[model samples]
Target: MVNKPVLPLSPIPKKWEKPLRGTVKINFDAAVSKTKTGFGVIARDSEGFVIGGGYGFKNEEMTGDWAKLYAFEESLKIARLLNITKVTFETDCAKHQ
Candidate 1:
């Protein structure tokens, strides 16, 4: 009998979904590096049309969770600047231990 090594499985990719009618979906993400932390957000209407988007970075080290929270806060500012009333926020960052 031959022995085989076990391998880890990759996570399944998820497709982006459109928001409900008369509402906008804001997706945000954060990237943390040794030197800086970066974040980006995009707002799309129910039809998947981009209404607004923004990206920013800070020259400071931060944790992944903190970066994600910062990204969420920035996204809210953008939404307010755009006068968006109905919004749905989405983020890919999971809770870290």
Candidate 2:
């Protein structure tokens, strides 16, 4: 049996925007609540298997937009580094389109 890998979405560095071509899609999403903020990313293969999933949070923020943006941007970078996985993103914050 082969061990599957997991990409923990935390400490998203400043660099994750650079694109890399591969056989995978990335999905990302962010949710903003009155008390806290949440953002996560999931990677799937062509067959739709959950290769890996991760999410980080920023608590006690007055503005959801900042948290959402930071989370989204960081998530993207994290996704790019992990190769051979389809990346997809989802977010409760719709304004971040």
Candidate 3:
């Protein structure tokens, strides 16, 4: 019998889509580490132009799920501050238990 080596599978790349006219899209992401957590949010218009963006880091530790939620909350705050009425949110965080 012969043994075969196994290779790790790679994730498929996804393309970003623009939002509809008269609306803005916000993409958010989070990073968690042993010492701190960080998040970023970017807002773009239908024309694919950057309207606003924000990023921040905290000195506390947290789980990936919590960090993702924090990123979402920050995105909402940015949208509100910009007086955006029609908005779409995007996140790459997968649900985990």
Question: Would you list the clashing residue pairs of candidate 3?
Answer: none
Name the candidate that leads on TM-score: 1
- Over 1-97, each residue of candidate 1 has an lDDT whose tens digit, in order, gives 9754433245557788999999999999998999899999999999999999899999999998889999999999999999999999999734545
Per-residue lDDT over 1-97 for candidate 3, one digit per residue giving the tens place of the 0 to 100 score: 9754433246557788999999999999998899999999999999999999999999989998889989999999999999999999999735544
Query: What are the per-model numbers of colliding residue pairs?
Result: 0, 16, 0
TM per prediction: 0.86, 0.51, 0.86
What is the Cα-based lDDT of residue 68 in candidate 2? Answer: 64
Native-vs-model 1 lDDT?
Answer: 0.91
Of the candidates numbered 2 and 3, which has the greater TM-score value? 3
Model 1 / residue 13 / CA error / Å: 1.1
Task: Name the lDDT value of residue 94 in candidate 2.
Answer: 36
RMSD versus native structure for model 2: 14.9
Per-residue lDDT of model 2, residues 16-42, tens digit only: 232334444456766678887787877
